[model samples]
Target chain A: MKPTARWIPYFLVAPAFAIFTLAILGPIIATFGLSLTDWDGFSTPSFIGLENFVRAFNDKVYTSSYGHAAIYIVATLVLEVLVGLILAGLVSAKRNTTFYRVAFFTPVMLPLVVISVLWSFLLNPDLGILNRILDQVGLESWKHIWLGDQSTALLSISVISGWIFAGFYMAIFYAGFQRIPSTIIESARLDGASELQLLRQIKIPMIKNLTEVAVLLCVTGGIQVFDLVYVLTNGGPYDTTQVPTTYLVRVVFRDQQMGYGSALAVILTLVVVGFGLIYNKLRTKDDSVVEY
Target chain B: MFKGKRLIAGMAVGLLGLAVLTGCSKGDSADKVLRIATPSLGDSELPVWEAAKASYEAAHEGWTVEFIQQDDDLYSTVGLPTLLNGKNSPDAYFEWAGARLDQRVAEGFAADISTDIESSGLKDLFNDGAFAGYDSGGKLSMIPRARDVTNVLWYNVDMFAKNGVTPPKTWDELNTVCAKFKSLKINCFVQGNKDLWTVGNWGGHIISRVAGEALYAETLQKKKPMNGPEFIKGLTVLSDLAKNGYVNESVNSIADNEAASLFFQGKAAFHPIGSWLVGTQQDQAPDFKMDFINLPAITDGAGDQDSIMAVFTGYIVNAKSSKKTEVLDFFKELYSPENAKKIADSGTVLLVKSLAGGTLDPLTAKINALLDGAKVVVAPPDTGFELPVADALNAAQAEVIGGKSTPQAALDAAQEKVAALK
Candidate 1:
């Protein structure tokens, strides 16, 4: 590039960079610094180095919330990934692609907050039709309190969350499916391969990148699932549903222990970055398998 | 090349438009705005907020008054620290209890209200017990608002009458009454502990009974470790309520409002909630016949059942605001005979003397009378409670009731956490 053009990219990017630095980087720095002290967010933060980290590891709520998150990650990600792959396999062929694409991706259009609220209302006990239907079918004893039961509270949150995002992943897989050359799938089908055989043997291997993306998205979403859990459960039914973000929120906001909350946030950020990195490395290795 | 030039011009115009928009939002340079932070949206504080802002604006006429109702975190966390930063702060605000405000005063963030109290003749208006929290190097930094009554045991009068289940006069009698209520298919006592504060049942009486008033005072007053036999017994009594099915099973998963609604909606016989339940009843459950009595004698002790758990919410002035005198004047105006009368009329048994109890809605009046008769009042057993004792009580007990944890293990774990709070 010429001298004038050399400055063009910098000028073009400067505003976005400045905004990101202020909005994201500044707070992260402040929170990290604050995490080192024993501050109640008001006092002259007594420099209690590593105490917050020590305390965070010892906190039962932290472990419990993370454990719940671990369960959610496996369940939601696995279901979404499996369903997305199957749907992508069935719809990869060229036939009214727009309709199939639209049908597969419709749920992604609705906001997660709205989905959470609508589902919670649908699952309400006394007034909700969910229990009423069970009662109508002469299964009155099977009527459930849904969100109010400890056994069902976290499970319900996970299912509702999964239902909201599974379609989005399906679209991702379908996009990856379309990117695969038509000749390869046609050749496999011509060789008398079944649909499941094609999916298991041919299509999935071709769309490994898409599988990686779906898993990564699910992992991040699982780690940071706040609004739905907050609106639906508020981390109750005995805190069986509290994830790290919500638990950290309760600590920082409700308890006013900014130091402890920041420590938890830092741990959460590390977990998220770590998970992202491991998946990235795994994907890189997987991609290296099909260099051809 | 001409199209590219036009595109550059369009981008420049967009940038200028954003700059102008940002400049416009920079807002009036001289408008004095007070950001009044609060715990929740639905609180009695909102009315006081509206009335105070109106009074301030009416008095000042030129200045703009803003009520920035923050989320639950702001009051004790972001709001307090932001205000204490001394450059940007609220002019006047309200806070609850001593610990939060005491920290503020110690940090020199609270404006000394000694002169304001003297000049405005506010000293005479405040009662003796209200004087308890005004200490700070012999200058009052804050003024008490009103007493928040805790440790109320509300039993369904209708349920008791129909089933011959009389109100308990003693802990044993309370147990018997619970048995009777259970036999009649009543949930007995209703509370939702999913949040922890729901664990503050009527059984918290064992604290006063076993530990006695002086030891309870010693613990809170002296910052003693609360893992003693008395406290354990108190928690055991609370656990026993769970064991006997006195505490509703839905508690672990249910919320405060949900549990209270279940009670007033007649799902339970007794609900040990704060005195504010009277206000809730006045607003939501006017037809629900109920009676809120004090704790029964847990140990056949001398302490009357009339003793209650109470805290005084206070009005605090900001050290950072320039309109300190104006805000103080506005506070005096707001708390004057007219507005305090409005507060009393809103069903708050305020510290203001000689205010009529306003027909006292029969059940509320009975509770208020019993409260008036109390020889002493205590908190809901938990003091300087990190989360409001009432809220934590609900959450801790809900976990136990939900089968998430055993009551003893849960409370022990909760107590360990509570004991560790600085």
Candidate 2:
């Protein structure tokens, strides 16, 4: 390769590298440093070693938020990934695939803020049509003040978040379905293999990598959940729906405890990165790639 | 190959140009332009700010004053910190005068405006209580804009009269009034507890009334436990209302405006809110004549019955600014008799003595009367304690109202948190 050609690859990647360094890496380093201090956002930081981390582990609110996040992760993994795969299976089997794709993915196009606010109105116990419909259908006992009830608030938020992103996950799974060669499926069908059997036995195994990717995305996204909970419940009705990011906000901004907030943020990052790494390790441990 | 070399060189030049264009700097000349940030966007004081900006620029030649409006939630937490940390902080910034301003003052973010106020005769312009929140070791830290009292009971006169309910003067009377309204299948109090702070405001007032100001102060200062008899008594009032269904079933779902709208639409009877509600009612619920009253006394309570939850919102000069004199000039213009009158005319209650004599709106007048009658105006519990404790208190109050936790249990948790803070 010519010197210019060799440098061209570096040149093409330079802008992105600079941006990542300045915007992402710099903040991560700063946050890690800040986590060891006891500074409010305004004051000069006083190093307090791992006291912030110690306090976080001891703090009920912080630990409770992590518990909420765990619930959210399981919820998203099931609702967004599993349900999305099912929807993808249905759409991939359909004649009008484009229409099905658009219909399923429509919620993904709307802003999450809009979706959360809209869901808040829809789930309101008194005025919302959801409760009214339940009343009309003689399922009045099933009606709930979904966002206001401590037992249901976090799950309700998770379901809404899942509903919003399910379509995006559907799209990913659909693409994976499309990438699968039709010849094998045709042969399987000719051999009297049912649609459900094909999906369960052949398609799923072929798209295992995509399924893993979707699970990773859902888990990491769940760990960082903030906007939906913030807009809908604000971790209210006794902080049942509180997540790490919202708790971090309350600490850093509301409590003005930047050092502690940074510690929470760092822990959250670690949780996400840790989950990703563990999931990757588990997936790659088989040392066998399922060839299409 | 030669073309590729030229292309690489060209890309390098373009990247440098982009850097030059996007690099951070003091974009505005400090001498030529003054920036002021406020949490007033279409709020009652927006017009007052606009008018002040126009007037100040008109009075001074070659000096442009830029007014930046930030959302209240964003401004209090995100905007202020970002501005303070940035290379070019605003010359003047709006702030809620409490622990928030205290934190800023402690960090030396605010210029000590004591000398400026004293020399400019602005010291005598405001009432003594206006400086209470901003005072640190006998120095005024910020300029007080107005004294805003929370926990005022704003009722629709028609609804009250229609229900044959008079303004309550005692806790028993208030309950009776609520019962009357509830008999008619109407919500007695339109509470926007969804915000948590709205309900927290009521909790603060109730605790202040039951425990007395000194005990409440001691509790906040960690001398007394939050879960004591005083707090339980106060929280029970709210819990009782919730249990009796006097408050809306969806109390935790609706916002302040939605609750007030219910009151205006005749679905509810009372709105116990801040003094700012007068201005809100003037603008939004103009057709409804809001009859204002103080919160009824707790029967045989130790605290003063007339005491209310009041706070001051004001401006602070950024210590990092190079244009202190210019910012001070604009602040003087903002609080001038003419501009303050404009603010008061918008149905806002002012702390300025000069603007206090104006022909205020009847609702504002009634609110001011309540403020005048207040024997001990305490800050909200959220403002009294540090943020974590205050947040826990807010959550505990929500728990009480939501039936998620009993008053004793929730307040006990709060008291434990408060004790630990000390």
Q: Output the number of the DockQ-best candidate.
A: 2
What is candidate 1's local distance difference test score?
0.69
Give candidate 2 regions above 4 Å deviation: A1-19, A285-292, B1-32, B43-48, B121-134, B319-324, B419-422
Q: Write the per-residue lDDT of candidate 1 for residues B265-339, one digit (tens) a residue.
A: 898888877777887787789888888666777764434445766655776777756666666666665566666
Instruction: Report lDDT per candidate.
Output: 0.69, 0.80
Please list, in the order the candidates appear, how each scores on TM-score for chain B only.
Answer: 0.78, 0.87
Any idea what lDDT model 2 has?
0.80
**Of the candidates shown, which would achieve the greatest TM-score relative to the real structure?**
2
